[model samples]
Target: MNEYPIEYYQFFIKFNEGDYYTCHDLLEDMWMEDKSNLFLKGLLQMSVAIYHYSYGNVKGTRLMMKVAHEYLQPYRPKQWGLDLESVIAYIEHCISIIPDDIDKVSFSKIEELPALPTLFLYLEDD
Candidate 1:
C-alpha cells in the first residue's frame, strides 16, 4: 500500500466538517506539486464545486462538478482509500439537479435544494 501525505487525510477532515473551502486549501499545494495527479486535482475540484453550491452559485457548481468528474473518472472503484466510484455517482447526482438555465434560479430557490449527504473516507483496512 502506498502511504498518503498528511494533507490527503486533512482534506477529508475538512470535507466532512462542511468546510469545503478549507478542503480545497488543504489539497491545493499537493495538486500544484503534481499537476499530473488526477486524484488530487479531482479532489480539489470537488471541494470547489461543493463550496460553490453552498454559496448558491449553480453555474459555478455545475462547471466545477463536471471538471471534477472528468479528472476522477479514470480512478473508478477505489484509490488510496478513497472510493472514486461512489464519489463520481454523488457528483453526477448533484449535476442532474442543477438547472441548465442557471440565470433564472434565485439564490433563495437554490437554498431550497436538498442538502448533500456527508462524505466519509474509509480507512484502507476497513
Candidate 2:
C-alpha cells in the first residue's frame, strides 16, 4: 500500500482532537502549493469553517461551509482515501446545527453543538 502524505495524518489528528484551527493551518500549506486541487481546498475550507464556528463566527462559518460543500461535491463517496460521504454528511449536520446568531451563543449554547467526527483515511498496516 502507498503511504499517505504526512500532512494528511496531521489533519486527521488535529481535526479529531477538536483543534480545527490547527487543522486549517496544517492544510493551508498544502493548499497553497496545489491551488487547483479542489479536494485540498475543500478540506481546508471545511477546517476553517469549523474553526470559525468554534470561535462563534456565524457568518464566516456559513460562508465557508457553502464554499466547502461546493468544492467537495465533485468528489463524492471517496477521495484521497477519505470517506467523503461521511464527511459531507457531517458538514451538512454542522450547517444545520450552527446558530444564525452566534454572537450571543454562550458556553451552554456551544455545548448544544454537535460533536464533529474525525476522518479516518485508509492506511496500510505496518
Candidate 3:
C-alpha cells in the first residue's frame, strides 16, 4: 500500500480525538493545497459535517454531508490505504439518522444523536 501523506495521518489524529473541527481545519488546509484531490476534499467536508452535527447546526450538517457524499462516492473501496467505502458508509449512516426537518430536532434530540465511530478504525493495515 502507498504511504499516506503526513497531513492525512494528522487529520485522523484530530478526528479520532473527537476534534472534528480541528480535523476540518487541518484537512481543509491540505485540500486547499491540492484542490484536484477529490478524496481529500471529501474527507474535509466529512469532518466539517461531523463538526456541524456536534454543534446542532442541522443545515450545515446536511449541506456538508451532501458535499462529502458527492465528492467521495467515486473513490470508493479504498484510497491510500483508507477504506473510503467504510467511510462513505459511516457518512451515509449519519445522514440516515438526521430528521427530515431540522426544526423537528431539538437540542435534546441532538444530544440523543448516536455517537459516531472513528473512521480510523476502518483504515486498512498496510
Using lDDT as the measure, the top candidate is 1
**Ranking of predictions according to lDDT:** 1, 3, 2
Structural similarity to truth (TM-score) of each candidate: 0.87, 0.80, 0.84
How much is the lDDT of residue 109 in candidate 3? 67
Residue-pair clash count for candidate 3:
0
Off by over 4 Å in 1: 103-110
Candidate 3 segments exceeding 4 Å error? 103-109, 112-119
TM-score between model 1 and native: 0.87
The best candidate in terms of TM-score: 1
Model 3, range 1-126, lDDT digits (tens) per residue?
A: 557668777887788888888887888788788899988889888888878777677778888888999999888887777888778888888788765577325566677665655565345674
Residue 6, model 1: Cα distance from true site in angstroms = 0.5
Residue 82 local lDDT, model 2: 82
TM-score of 3: 0.84
Name the better of 1 and 2 by lDDT. Answer: 1
List candidate 2 segments past 4 Å from native.
101-126
